[model samples]
Target: MADELLRASGLESGYGGVQVLWGADIAVAAGETVVLLGANGAGKTTLLRVLMGLMPAWRGTITLDGAAVTHETTDQRVRRGVAYMSELGVFPDMTIADNLRIGSRFAPRAARAAAIDALYARFPDLAGKRRSLAGSLSGGQRKMLGIAKALAGRPRLLVMDEPSAGLSPLYVAEVLAVLGRFRAEGLALLIAEQNVAFLDLADRVCTLERGRTVFTGTTAELHANDALERAYFGLT
Candidate 1:
């Protein structure tokens, strides 16, 4: 696990007086993509929230680059090479260019401009409308912009929650292609998604059941397990 970039063990957290995670464990290696798969209410989002520091861990340890970050604030985690993109992470009122600027604010002042420009070049749809408000874009475009913003900071690990959620088939394919490009560029990613199509992009898969990690293995391993796949994916 020397190449491990992010690790969470025995994670336990939830809303006030309500526990949602029970000793869950997950990890993402350097330059790897790990997908989180589970049924609804299985704590995928909760675990992600804890990992991103948006919620306190009732009991557990989160490490980034071999350093313990269990209690670090969200901003601290971001500064330590972690970037999170929630389902609706974009700032609706902000201009596309401004949003990218905010995303790269943590990056070195000298590098921020180039990074933003690079993202604009990569996502020309946004480039053509850089001056427009993010709110004006379609749902798919908003998600794309959110992703570009997250990458602006040059994070070592990018944690995303349902990047393909609420998108049309075409948009979903576009999002997956963008993710594939990033993966090829060696950006580590941990994604929580319900789309089975993600299996094509996953290097590993982790299944959560009732807040606990019931399975973690290669994508092929998950495919080979008939019952487990049926139980979680609702494939009869």
Candidate 2:
């Protein structure tokens, strides 16, 4: 499709010969949110790692904006307008601004300052705490900082693994609201999450079962087909 920003087909990858992904096919369009849902050990994080180029794909092709990126390094993919974020691994000792600075360093020098400034404007609270140690921030603020770091590179496609994995209800709402703005600003997002809190942010939902994509449809369709989801999660 003309709007498609990221496409992965026949993706198969695993750790040390233990095959995890089974010919997974997924796509994300510009300004669209595709929520990936699954139970524990369903290969959600593995799929994100493969998409971000953090892990090698045994077989498959990943295309971004019509260019093949299957063999591209994670840094290469980031420079090519793909950004990734996880629930962990923020630099706790660094200031919020500094963490973002590291993210923007790979971007063009001309755009770095402007990108940081724009992030501050989008996150006013962050603006107030820019110079403070990131470790001192609240759980929600730290997550926001992680998100800000990803945005510092100004990626067209954002691939996130469990953005709200261990947050309180209030924090989850805040994070989801932040993601909603990313969608409104025309950035494509592929999120792997187990929470239905993401339903409001998703344009489509895809469920994975035993490393395979078993359902892909609109949110309404997913809601109408509880039995399908139940079966995939082995609730039967």
Top candidate on lDDT is 1
Measured with C-alpha atoms, the lDDT of residue 1 in candidate 1 is 85
After superposition, candidate 2 runs with Cα above 4 Å error: 229-236
Local distance difference test values of all predictions, in order = 0.92, 0.88
Q: Candidate 2, residues 69-116: lDDT per residue as tens digits?
A: 999998988988888887673689999889899878788999999999
Note the residue pairs that clash in candidate 2.
Answer: none
Q: Report the C-alpha lDDT of model 1 over 1-236, residue by residue, as the tens digit.
A: 86988999999999999999999999999999999998788999999999999999999899998999998899999998889999897999999999999999899999999999999999999999999999999999999999999999999889999888899989999999999999999999999988888878999999989999989999889978999878756787
* Positional deviation of residue 139's Cα in model 2 after best superposition, in angstroms: 1.0
The weakest ten consecutive residues by lDDT in model 2 span 227-236
Candidate 2 matches the true fold with a TM-score of 0.94
